[model samples]
Target: MTVATDTLQAVEAVFAERIEAATALGGSWALFDRDGVVASGGAGIASLDPARPAPGPDTLFRIASCTKSFTAAALLLLRDRGLLDLDATARSFVPEFVPEIPGDLEVDPTVRMLMTMSGGLPTDDPWADREESMTREEFSATLAAGIRCASVPGTGFEYSNLGYAVLGQIIERVSGVAFTDFVTHEFIEPLGLDMRFELSAEEAVPYATGHRRVEGNGWLALPFTGPGVFSAIGGLFASVTSLAAWGSWLAEASTGAERGPLSAASRREMQQLMRVAPKRHTPPALPGAPTPPSPVVYGYGFGLFVEFDDRFGAIVSHSGGYPGFSAHMRWHAASGLGVVAFENATYARVSQGAELALAIVLDAADRVAPVSPSPAPWPATLEASVALSGLVNDWSDVAASAVLATNVGLDVPYDERRATIEAAWAAVGGRTAASRTPVDAECDSPDHLVWFLPGATGRLRVEVRMTPLAEPLAQTFLVKVESPEPSVA
Candidate 1:
């Protein structure tokens, strides 16, 4: 999990770049490696109005949907205790919790479906028109009796906030404890995470105010109450440091490095990609152009978005957005890189911040190995150079656009964008360079490039690596190509 010194430096640079960019947009961010905090940035805005206190690392922000992962983990722990079965139907725990769908559909959503978001439940309850407060049981029963099944259970993946709420009900029925209490006892206290399910009136004084953009002016905070029925879905408020600790635990649990409340096998299962997400409908272009769907597929395990990266390996991530707050957490198991970003203003900046933080980590991974002395052989012909020049021209524009889109938090249009970037380098450098030799191709995959650029004194080098769909590419350019001197100072 430990990265090389050069890689660490590169990672730090990437963080600095992203933090600067994010702050320019008026947001705060925090990043962490496995051990602890590596970097943090931006002003902790005290108020969007007249008077308020600035936020800090310890500032509690509503983690929103990030709470689902915690709920999923608690359920998994209960399964390990032999008190629950993931494959068992939800009806086993609460028969009244069955969906109000056509009987001929024969759709029986399992506990696994609920946890993974494949339960065929609508994103929210159709019947619950009002956001009135209610007990967890009343909410679950109303949802079960009122919610319609849009598709067959386990047939498709649809993220359901209500599904997780149903899960909270099941947790209560199975564990015979309040959902929040169970989570605190089973997961929160065990990890020593400085987080709480709800903010008390007095405690709310230190919390950052959530904001939403208005017409002419900037942002305004929205008043929200503590989790009543939706406690398990999106109720937790936490700081970046606490979220980082949670991510680290998830990474350790996934890799079998640490055993928390859940067993290693169960944790690995949580990281497994189980279902492909349906193509996300493009919303009208926001401040930026419409974001293209992520290149990576979505999964249904532990309510997480799991994807494999060519560089950092497996990543587990989730994004949460509340009225005036946004949060994101991404953890790379192989590289032991964990990033968490939170913003008090609900400007949808959480995803952007997370992407920037991930870029930093991947950039570091790119520098893990020194560039080899030999470079890839070039085709010794002017025609080849001409052809490559055209290719590079086209690819550079594509790469630039792709990089811009990635940086600005837009969707990538094509899956081959990174490949094109690497191919562009090969085409351009392979044909135009005066001299070239085959370097180590071990790190040269379809998605990544790591090599040295020969120079008079030594060499100038570049390294490029792909990140998870949620993040941007981790790349480092103009790395000093060091060489042994010929017995002279």
Candidate 2:
């Protein structure tokens, strides 16, 4: 797969844009093109000491849930050996892995469901106490027993970390090895990833420290961990260079140029759309704004999010965050334009940075060649709509409140604040008219839409900033929603 120089230059511009955007938000990032690191930016939180220097291609950052794709790929490797069946029930291998529901509610969720996150298992609450202390087995069992099915088995999409955790268990059962060990033995060693699930003190010295912000003060380092517990869900640490090598392999596997560890057919299957998850339900604070979903639909084959740009006629690829770190890898199979971003921040910061990086890449790609039409839109689901609406509402409230408190007087009552904000928005131009220009746009997920708003000087600006819930809560940009146009008919 060859990328033209012009296309590569556009990608470089995008990378530079993201680096600037990320630094403004006080984060650090590294980006890679097919050949290698084209550009890098922001030592911000990643560097506490100015003299220490910024992260480079070899600097390691935790890949977080991006690990799930590798885990899913490993499972496919097992499938290649006929060691396990994708269609088999969870109970087939781990007999004790039964869903702990009432007699009438018993549904034998298949391994496919787990792989696609449609396993009908309870979505794990990252904040829950159950997650903190439970062993992997106990955690899986608890979720299986307690999860309520929102839809029939393998029906609707619900993002479930628990489901992937179960997948780790399946890999263990089939490979006769622990999940991490399987990854190490099969993929890491074969590819020579030069990465590991955990770092020793010596290794840690050179690695970027994950950070979160303190409410009143500055950034602080986050607690560190090895990939012992979250091996299947959110683990794995590597440099951008090594990850680009992995991405190049994926591009080859997807395009039939090179046979990956899995067969080409299996790789294609992994990239096919499995189920459409609900959209982010939080609304934009301003009227007529568009709120993007997490992923319009998820593809089981690749074990990652696939966004379709009808205008671009391409599949936008993705994978993302966990507690202590975040990462993103995207490639347009048709164009051979790819971007890989790695950050050592919490989930939100990484996600924001990833989205920005994606926008930068897509903008560059568009400049190189007139982007082809996007693939057909996947079927929308009620679940997705609900999720999207909720996100819009949340975003709307937050934005409105911020505007009222900062731009207007701070002592306004809740109802009055909303009314004032709405009135202010109406005065600006009303929801029916276009008021703001999109500085940048990218498909963040299969159906999720992301755009950037520019400040007066024409620099891209983020709408909302978030601090992690934990101590040393890192500050990162949050998703910004655009107002929708009123119907003309």
Candidate 3:
């Protein structure tokens, strides 16, 4: 078996140190595996009040645009329920999002465009954050006045809070329930998440005041804003504990290990790349860490964006920022490990800290000696080929040619293959029988099954490729034997 990373301790240490170096007011962090939470804790204060305790696992922080994924999922759940069409334009439901510019109408800006952030609306984080508490009337008025389009609806990547706000509006109109109510009931409740769009005192988590690092004035405390039109854009309030749970669930979804409320299929669909985020940059490698050299390009899904590394693979995640808080979460789909971090400092870029910590953790994981991954089920076609291998021992015109493609027989003429096998048998002094373990399912060849068998003296490698014909034939066949050095007479 492969060595377990047991990376919880290392991940936590790096996470805490990163937060300390970032000089944020205070922060919390957690690490998780696909099955469940691995480790969770927080450093720094949750509230400035002396009477209040330091931030703990349950302390609440505004998750900001991380809420977008929930909004996107909510939309998908609506689709799953047949309440809305992803291809339908926002005008069909809300009837208030007036598109100001008309272009070559190949694909209209539908719910899909909004979910993918490809609606051509200009990147409006600054404007959107402040409007988190906008009333429905105000939002309607703003949209009705006509929306600006930076490019044709489906042509470019522009992160727009307006698009999500419109989606929230559509959810409201179609479901006949407020966005917060419907979301809390349908999505949050099912996931067992203690997430909220509004923070209050009576709940388990005490509200951590957001602090702004002023140019010369030091830290200025900021209050949490409440529900409004754009609330769907960045209105989630949760703890690292809860966020870790969220990340863990999503990682499981990625591998179809766990499905709750949202089917594994739908969850996987939500994490798919819909648009490339051009502005994302390669996060600086962690200090003194052996990071795999991989290009970092931000690609958006429903509400998620993954940064794919060539050697390591996809890290699915999203970051959040509000006036007084910053948060981020990342999980490896296959590995099911992730990091979630939250800070009570405005624009502190906590996302980078989470990213750096994950890199360090993953680098550590890479050094681990890997246990052979479990194989997928052996296909029946491949099983038949293995059975055909029995006939190879007594090859004749009909026996070899029946299962073998004409080209395969030509490549290594029956005579050449027969001679190769006989030579190995001669070295062993007898034709030693071969035995094979179960076929490795991780074989990546789309049309071939490749495996090795432990023989009496050495090993035998078997490879069979499928042909393009009605009856399956071995397009290519290989049998290689590496005999141990001949025993001294």
lDDT of 1 by residue, 37-124 (tens): 6665445463565555666667778888888888888898888889999999987887777676645576788999888888888776
- Over 1-489, each residue of candidate 2 has an lDDT whose tens digit, in order, gives 244565444444443454456422233344444444455454443556565546766677777666777888888889889898989997787665666543456678888888888877666636421242246666656655655554566766777776677788788878889888889888888877867777764544456767654667755666556554456786777777777677666655555654446676666666666767554332121122122223443344447766554444435455566554567776665554566676654554444444444454555556666544333312332222233223322335454433222322233344553454344444333332122444444433333333443333222222322232322111222222233433110
Report the Cα lDDT for candidate 2. 0.55
- lDDT: worst 10-residue window of model 1: 480-489
Cα RMSDs, all models: 14.7, 18.2, 5.9
Off-target runs (Cα >4 Å) in candidate 3 are: 1-6, 102-107, 201-204, 254-259, 292-298, 366-401, 404-442, 445-489
**Candidate topping TM-score:** 3
**What stretches of model 1 exceed 4 Å from their correct place?**
1-27, 49-51, 125-133, 279-294, 347-349, 370-489
Residue 355's C-alpha lDDT in candidate 2? Answer: 48
Candidate numbers, best lDDT first, in rank order: 3, 1, 2
Candidate whose lDDT is highest: 3
Winner on TM-score (2 vs 3): 3
Would you give me the overall lDDT of model 1? 0.61
Ranking by TM-score: 3, 1, 2
